[model samples]
Target: MTKKSRRTHSPAFKAKVALAAVKGDKTLAELAQLFDVHPNQITLWKNQLLEGAAGVFG
Candidate 1:
């Protein structure tokens, strides 16, 4: 069997996923399936967005 290559996402895509996560309109599993990404990845991006949000205005 062949190994699958890792995928890379753009900042915009990350932001979109993160925003969806922050909205709390859906569960992580639902978001993951909808966005075709892992739930943990969505959590990571959400944390990153929250951590950096303050910097945008500072």
Candidate 2:
């Protein structure tokens, strides 16, 4: 069997997923399925967004 290549997501896409995660309208699993990304990745993006938000205003 052949190995699958790693996928890279654009910043826009990551921001979209991160925003959805922050909205808390759906579970991580639901968001993962809807966005076709791993739950951990969503969490990472969410944290990154929160962390960087402070810098945006500063």
Candidate 3:
């Protein structure tokens, strides 16, 4: 069997995912399924977004 290559997500794409997570309209699992990514990945992006949020005004 051939091994599938891992895909690298772009910054813009990550930001989009992070934004969606922050919106809180959908569950992490739903976002993960919609984006074809793992739920942990979305959670990580959300954490990054929250961490960076404080920098906007500082």
Candidate 4:
């Protein structure tokens, strides 16, 4: 069986995913399905967003 290659999402796409996580309207699974990515990726982006939020005011 051929292995499926991992796809690279663009920065804009990642930003969109991060924005959706910030909005918190949908669950991680929903975001993952909608964006065609893994839930862990969404969680990672969400965490990154939260971590970087503190720098915006500095």
Best by lDDT: 1
Which regions in candidate 2 have their CA more than 4 angstroms from the true location?
Answer: none
* Better model by TM-score: candidate 2 vs candidate 3: 2
Q: What TM-score would candidate 4 get against the native?
A: 0.83
* Candidate lDDT values, in order: 0.99, 0.98, 0.96, 0.89
Q: Over 4 Å off in model 1, which ranges? A: none
Relative to the unseen true structure, what is the Cα RMSD of model 4? Answer: 1.2
lDDT tens digits, residue span 11-35, model 2: 9999999999999999999999999
**C-alpha TM-score for every candidate:** 0.97, 0.96, 0.93, 0.83
> Model 4: per-residue lDDT, tens digit, 3-44?
999899887888889999889999998988998889999989
Between 1 and 3, whose lDDT is larger? Answer: 1
Which window of ten consecutive residues has the lowest lDDT sum in model 3? Answer: 37-46
* Residue-level error in angstroms, candidate 2, position 30: 0.5
Candidate 1: residue 2 Cα off by (Å): 0.5
How good is model 3 by TM-score?
Answer: 0.93
Range of the 10 consecutive residues with the lowest summed lDDT in candidate 4: 44-53
Please list the residue runs of candidate 4 whose C-alpha ends up more than 4 Å from where it truly belongs after superposition.
none
